[model samples]
Target: MDGSEKPPRGSAAHRVEAALLEEIAAGGIAAGERLDETRLAERFGVSRTPIREALSRLAAQGVLESGEGRGMRVAQYSREELAQMFEAMHEIEALCARLASQRLTLLARSQIEVAQAECKAAAEAGDLPRYLRANEEFHLSIYRAIENPYIFEIAADFRRRTGPFRAKKFADAGDLVASAESHDDLLEKIFSANSNIAAEGMRQHMAASFLRVLAAN
Candidate 1:
């Protein structure tokens, strides 16, 4: 099987959680800033229930933390925590790349090409936000291309925890361009269906990415 079958989409609560997480990662929501459920509900144009559910999920994922007076705020990461998280993320993504290289079907390859194209366009246009969004999709395409649901789920979970720092990399235009170039190399290797080379490319990409993020921080 091509593993190109689109996985089932997440629930509304999950969508809301993703939006909030993206905002947090993009620095729209500052660390230690309280997340008022009522305000978030109003802002997202949804009821409190979904917002509460989203907030809870973020908290569980360690993206948010309990605050005084029974409230919650954006979670901050220490250097050690950040390093550990990125290390784990690299392993997870590298494994996905290896599996995907062996299992990718024609359709899966096409999907990844589309994401890489979007990434290139965004990078050329100097659209940091668009590039970052496309970058996320590009990586996700690799994860899904692996055709292993359990692996995808685990990688996704770690992504949520480390995403804020990963997203922070776009703040540097030079880094953004470098990342785009790296994606080109990565896509070429994956499309070649060389599992070892693809995995190595992914590992090197993550190493470079972590260094960039570490420098930025």
Candidate 2:
């Protein structure tokens, strides 16, 4: 997918959750800010039940915190927690790149290439939103290339947790250019079917992201 397609109606809950998560990541909602269920329910045009479910799911995933009388708030990661999460994510995504390199079908590889092209175009045009979405699709394309549902799921979960930091990093021109170059290297390694190179490349790619986060704080 090119990242513009909407999720199926059957998966509306997931779509809602993703939208809310993106808002939080983009700083539309500040960290530690409590989310009112009724307000969100009205805003999203969904029932309180679904809003509650989505909030609880995010809380379980460590993207939100829920407790006595405070309701749900955007999660605030300590520096230590952020470091650990980024390291864990780097390791997992590195493995995914290795597996994807070895397992990618021609179709998957082509799809990733297309996403990369779109991301490059968006970046060059300074289209932040499009660039962000295409960037996400580019990585998801790699996860899909691995053809392992569990690996894809784990990578996505890690992404959700780190989305805010990632978005902020890419807002910098230098960081966006560096990220695009890393995508070029990653794609080349995958194309060559060099799993080790792909793994290392992916690790280095995420290392930059982690560094950016560290540099920010």
Candidate 3:
């Protein structure tokens, strides 16, 4: 789950899970990286049970697969598989953009604009970690504006699956700035109040992003 679909607030296992999700999304953890419960426990200052539980949840969600011994590794997909997943993500995000444009509110616009400002600022400052977090927030704000929980969950799941993959495309401040700037046109279309236009804009945006990821790969 992404930060948006957080598993309750205070469960130890969930805490570990959430933290790991952010680390993975931010590219701190590489694809197919192996994780051991004991190491995770020590890193998080928690008992092994919670580490086990967290890993189990990730496994259940297909984010991790069993590795050698008692370890688990991050799920990594072949290029063909990633392309297929990106195709689906393209459609879902377009739908989300459509709905968000149709059902936009003042608060949602404010939130998106604020998130984008932070994203641009972080990129300009060459602060990758902050930009990653802000990027996630920017999309989450858009997802929430659609006012559909099921769609939000679907979008969030896709984001989680592709986060690490997408993170690879940004290797430096210039790359991050380009990504942040790309959002400007999309936001304009999303705020245009024309659902078809918004959807098409998002489709184009996602197409460019997918191509970038492929190039990076």
Candidate 4:
């Protein structure tokens, strides 16, 4: 299956949670900023019930932490924690690329191309949210190509933890466009069916990405 999330559910709480997560992934919310339920209720045009539910779910996921007076704040990580997470993700992604290149499914190839096109378009349009979503799907296409649920779940979890911090690197359309272009070499190596080439290419790609994120921090 493609990497797109399921169609929006009917539950208001679910919708709010997803929307907030997207904003978090887009770097719209900074760590340690308190979330006010009343303000969120006004922002999402929903009652406090859904907002509270959404906050509770994110808190459970470790994306948020308890704040002053029972409110919640965005989760923060120390530099070392960020480095450890990125290190794990880097190796996981490299392994996925190696396997994906070896096993190159037609469905995954098609999905990857589609996601890349979206990435380019969103980058050109300078839409950070759109670009971030497209970027997620693009990498997910590769992870799915490996056809291993365990690796996929591990990679996705790492992504969930670092998406916001990773997003801080892109400050403008130029940054976004450059990031999208950086995918080209990795895609070529992945399509080559050379495991070593694919893995190394992915490792380099992630190295550069981590450096950018580090600089942003």
- Candidate topping TM-score: 3
lDDT string, candidate 4, 1-217, tens digits:
1122232377888888888886775567877779999999999899998787788777777788888888899888888889998999999999999999999988899999999999999999999889998998899889999999999978877776787788888988999999899898899999999999999999999999999988888
Best by lDDT: 3
The superposed Cα distance between candidate 1 and the true structure at residue 147, in angstroms, equals: 0.9
lDDT tens digits by residue: candidate 1, 1-217: 1122221248656678878876765455656779998898888788987777777777877788989887888887887888998889999989999999999999899999999889888888888778767887788889999888999888877765666666766666776677888898988888788999989999998998898778766
Q: How displaced is residue 79 in candidate 4, in Å? A: 1.3
lDDT by residue for model 2 (1-217), tens: 2123333465645667788876764445656778898898888888876677677667766788864595988777878988998989999989999998899898998999999998888777777667777787898899999898998988887776676666766556655666677789878887889899989988888898798877775
Cα TM-score per model: 0.86, 0.85, 0.94, 0.86
The lDDT of model 1 is: 0.80
lDDT of each candidate versus the true structure = 0.80, 0.78, 0.88, 0.86
Per-residue lDDT of candidate 3, residues 53-158 (tens digit): 7888887777778888878998898999999999999999999999999999999999999999999999999998888889988998999999999999888878
RMSD of each: 5.5, 5.2, 2.9, 4.6
Candidate 4 or 2, higher lDDT: 4
Of candidates 4 and 3, the better by TM-score: 3
Q: Which residue pairs collide, candidate 2?
A: none
Give lDDT: candidate 1, residue 73: 89
